[model samples]
Target: MIHITLPDGSRKPFEDQPTGLAVAKSISEGLARECVAMEVDGQLVDLNRTIENDAAVRLITTRDPEALEIMRHSAAHVMAQAVMHVYPDAKLTIGPVVEDGFYYDIDMQPLSEEAFPEIEAEMKRIVKAKIPVERHEVSKANALEFYKNEPYKTEMISELADGTISFYKQGDFTDLCRGPHVPHTGFVRAFKLMRVSGAYWRADQSKAQLQRIYGTAFFDKKQLKAHLEFIEEAKKRNHRKIGTAMDLFSFHDDAPGMAFFHPKGMAVWNALLDFWREAHREAGYVETKTPIILKRALWEKSGHWENYRENMYTTEVDDEAYAIKPMNCPGGMLLFGTRPHSYRELPLRVAEIGLVHRHEMSGVLNGLFRVRSFHQDDAHLYMMADQIQSEILDLLRLEEKMYSQFGLDFHLELSTRPEKSIGTDEQWEVATEGLRAALDAYGRDYLINEGDGAFYGPKIDLHIKDALGRTWQCGTIQLDMSLPERFDLTYVGKDNEKHRPIMLHRTVFGSIERFLGVLIEHFAGKFPLWLAPVQAVLLPINDDLIPFAEKVASTMIQAGLRVEVDDRTESLNRKVREAQLAKTPLILTCGGKEKEAGTVSVRTLDGSVHYGIPMQQFMQQVTAHVAERRLELDLFEK
Candidate 1:
């Protein structure tokens, strides 16, 4: 008999070699029906795989996060089969699931729109066939022979060590994979063929370009529909579109990956900088700035000249080589070395809103997220060993304050030292303990991710949750002993001897440009009063009321408020509509009645109209909204 431990901490003895499906059926029919895959003794396996020894079991279904991944993997296989049916000669490469969908790379030429219908039709046929996907284990030699004609697959097999490989088969189609896929091909109900493009086999420019078909899928029809609708909505809110609509920013071909912030965009930029400066000052952080170009020897000493030379842009000054700064740390290190310090002046926190540049692949160049030039909210702390815990605690506290203000909920993950780390065991022990105690002091829950740290140190990452429920890694705190040792950064101890200082590198908003894009998407282009480029717009009902509207705009602007005037010959309703479309928070209209009564008609983004409020009263309401950065600002001004 074999004892199987279930997820609920209960054990059941099976008299013979029973499959995971058999165990599930014994427990509950509902669970058995939903169960798609299982794990035995920490190894994920197919439900049909027989379990003969004592082990731990976990059944994964559509309800599990990992199940979505498995289902999408099977969906990719169905898509591959569909493609093969349409173009019998098309050679398959890789079809893997990502984020919310799957993409398949095939070695085909010049695929166009005319191909989608035939491929989709073939997909329907495969779905109707309800083909059972059988998984088989094959030796490495067998796999290479089976895919001898398929160069990509053959290359993959050649790279594999001497071991058994898993292959999935549906109908006459089979592909090499390691998977615990869904039950059958018929399970792909909600699927969509999004787009097609060309991609290099391994993203290497020298490699042959392959045809890539991108698609998305969901478990149910409604969810898929909603997903498509959500995508459409996101397109509407895309910064590329909204930036032009609001006259915020633009991108030029000459400076492909650089953004040109217009006047309105400058207002938003200043707003962020103002808030950042205020927070850093209150958090005991001293701000510093560094030059954009530095000597090549500096980068060489930082180890980036060797490892990151490909990404760093080089130039020459007076026949000597210099490199454009790709990072701010080396400059910060130079500053730390400029002055000798003592233990009494320890825990020195230096911050920089430094601009950096790098050569990113053209394929991966996104709006503001993956730009060639951007600013980092970077900080580096030089402290004694005893101050490590308190420094991390301070950084976390500041991170919480900044993120909460942006309506971002964050989770912490403590990444342990990697296999090839630079620190001694004693140093790692002290640093790890410091981080653990800091986490405990805040009473926050965090999971240990083994071997995910940087090459030089251990760290903690804060994943910020967006409105779409997606987590973006935006904050990090890394402890480094190697850099200090390399730079010979020292502080005098109480015994008058020099001791190496521990360096803690941290960033709250990892990239200012990316954070700005996130803010745009999170707020859905309807920025709060404080962050809005034009917080208020003054609208006059007619030509006669133009003077009063301008007066009100001027007054608001003088009071440190961002306000604009729309005194065009357009109708009152048209002006209001334009302001609403621009996503401005508040609009004050000056009609004859409002002008005569020393009042204004206030309107909001939500289309609420409030009539006859004194200008002072309306300003009070606006100030309150701006002060709180309210999610739902009151339209009423009385």
Candidate 2:
């Protein structure tokens, strides 16, 4: 007999060679139908795999989280099979599951989006057939011989050290994979082909170019419908589209990925920076500026030349190599080393809004979200070991206060040490624990992301949610012990002996440009009065009332409101429509009646109109609203 321990710690004695499916069948027919895969001694495997020894097992049903990935993997195979059915000349390379979806790369003739319907129909036919997916192990030599016609598969097999390779087969289609897929093709209930793009074989530019098909899958038809709806909504909220419509920013072919902020865009940028400076001031931080270019020797000592050289741009100056700064930490380190410190000055906080450059691939260069040149709101803190936890708590509090100002909701994630990292194991443990302790003290639940930290230390990431329920990673706090050691930074201890101070690297806005992009989508270009590029616009009913409109605009501008005058020879309704399209918060109109009464008619973005408001009271109310930085407009409220 073989003993099997379940997830709930129940032991069941089974006869020799009992399979996971047999166990599920013994429990209940409904469970057996729902079970798509099983975990045998912590390793996910096919439900038909025989249990030969005593071990713990967990049956994965369709409702479990892991089941989705299993189903998606099966869906990828089904997609590949469907493509082969439609186009037998296509050669498969590889398929893998990505965040929220899956993709498969195949060498085939270039096709457009119009071909998606035919391929999808074939995929649905395969799923309805319910062909059983079987896994088998073959010798390496046999695998190479079996894939002799497939160059990509043969090349992959040549690199593997294992003597036996795994392959999954369904119906007349077979592929090379190490997978824990669903029991059959029918498990892929609902799936859609999202798009087709050009990709180089194995992601190498020199290799053969292939067509990559992207897709997503879900268990229920309703879930698939919801996902498609979200995608459509996101397309409508795209910052690039909204930014151009509002005339706030633009990108040029000459600059490639750099943004050109117009005068109106600069207004929004200045407001955000001003707010950041004020909050940092209250948090006891002193701001500083650093050089945009530094010597290559400095980066070598900081370890970036060895690990991050590919992403850096370099040039020769004065017979020496120099690099445009890709990060602000090394320069901040140099500044810290310029002066000696005492324990009394411990926990010293320094901030910088530095512009840096990175050579990002053209494929990933998004509008402002992923750019070549951007500003990072970086701050570094030097403190004693005992001050680590308390300082982290303070940083968390500051982050919360700043994000709340934007009306954004956020969650915490703790990322531990990465594989390609510096510092000793002990240092990494201490750094990770310090952040963990601070998060615990903050009284919020956080998720652990294994091996996703910075090169120097573990970190905490703040992912903020937008209005559409999508999360954006905007803030991070990393604890570093290696940089201090590398830079030989020191401070006098209480006993008058020198000691190395620990460093904490953090940023509330990971990139100001990216945060601005997030804000654009979060508010759908409808900014609050204070953050609006043009807070209010004045429209005269006719040419005769232009003087009164100009007078009112001057008064509002002097009162610190961003006011504009519509001096165009357009009708009042046309001017109002244009202003509304521009997302102006306040629309003020002056006519013969209002001009004679020393008043103006007020209109807001929400189509609310109030008549005959005195100019003086209007200016006062607008000024107060901006000064308070109110997220909502309560103007003309009784």
Per-residue alpha-carbon lDDT of candidate 2 for residues 264-372, written as tens digits (9 for 90 to 100): 9999999999999999999999999999999999999998898889989899999999999999999999999998899999899999999999999786799999999
Q: Lowest summed-lDDT stretch of 10 residues in model 2?
A: 198-207
| Candidate 1 colliding pairs | none
lDDT per residue for candidate 1 within 1-638, as digits (tens), equals 98999989999999998988899998999998788789898888788789988999998876888877787888889889988877888888999999879999999877976788788788878877878878999899999889999999998889999999989999889998888887777767778888898899888889888999988877788989999988887777677778789888888999988888999888888888888888899988899999989999988877778767888989999988899898888899989999899899888989999999999988888888789988888999999888888889889999999898888999999998887666688878777778888898988899899888876678999999877776888899988887788788899999999999999989888988888888888887888789899998988877877888888888888778999889888877788888888999888877788878988877878777888888788788777777666666764743
Per-residue error (Å), model 1, residue 285: 1.2
Question: Highest lDDT among the candidates is held by which one?
Answer: 2
Q: What is each predicted model's overall lDDT from 0 to 1? A: 0.85, 0.92
Candidate 2: list runs displaced more than 4 Å: none
CA lDDT of 286 in candidate 2?
97
